[model samples]
Target: MARILIVDDAKFMRLTLSNILQKGEHHVVGEAENGTQAVEMFEAEQPDLVTMDITMPELNGLDAMKKILSNNPKAKIVMCSAMGQQKMVVEAIEAGAKDFIVKPFDESRVLEAINRVLG
Candidate 1:
C-alpha cells in the first residue's frame, strides 16, 4: 500500500479522503489544511503520493504542486478538483500532476487514479 498525504482546506473533505484511502489499504501519513503546510509535510513525511485540492487560501494547489515538484521532481501528485475546473485540471497534468480525481469523489475512480499514478 502507498503512503498518502491528503491536502484539503476543509476538514470534512480531508476526513472523507482519509477514510477512503484507508479502506483501500493506503496509509494516511498526514493531512494538510493549506498548500504551505502541504509543502512542509511533503518534505517531512515524504509520502509516496499526494491528493491535492485545487483551491485553498494561503496558496492554491497548482502553485503548491509546482513548489513540491521543484523540490522533488519525482513527486507523484493527483489533483482533487471541483467539477467546473477542467482548465486547472489540464494545467495540473502539464505541470506534473500524475492524475486527478474530480471533487465529490467516487471511491472507485479515486482508487483507480491512485493505482494508475502509482503504476
Candidate 2:
C-alpha cells in the first residue's frame, strides 16, 4: 500500500481524507495542517503520495507544490481545491501535481484519482 501524507487546514477535511486513505489500505503516514508543515513533513517522511489543499495559511498549495517538486522531482502530489478555483487547478497541474480533487469530495472519485496516480 502507498504511504500518503494529508495536508489541509480543516480538521474535518484531514480526518475525512485520512479515513478514506486508511479504508483504501493506503498508509496514512502523516498529516499537516498547512503548506509549510506539509513541506517539512514531506522532506522528513518522503511519503509515496501527498494530498494538498490549495487555500491554506502560512503558504499556499501552489507554492508548496513547487517547493516539494523542487525537493523531489518525482513527488506524487494531488491538489485539493474548492469549486470555482479552476484556474488554480490548472496551475497546479502545470506545477507538477499528478491529479486534483475538487471540494465536497467524492470517495469514489478520490480513490480513483489516487489509484490512477499511484499506479
Clashes of 1: 0
Q: What's the distance in Å from true for residue 73, model 2?
A: 0.1
On residues 31-84, what C-alpha lDDT tens digit does candidate 1 reach at each position? 999999999999999999999999999999999999999999999999999999
lDDT (10s digit) by residue, model 2, range 1-119: 99999999999999999888888899999999999999999999999999999999999999998999998999999999999999999999988999999888899899999999999
Each candidate: what lDDT? 0.96, 0.95
TM-score of 1: 0.98
Q: For candidate 1, give the lDDT of residue 104.
A: 97
> Candidate 2: lDDT of 95?
83
lDDT of 1 at 35: 98
Residue 9: error of model 2 in Å? 0.5
Off by over 4 Å in 1: none
RMSD of each: 0.5, 0.5
Worst 10 residues of 2 by lDDT: 16-25
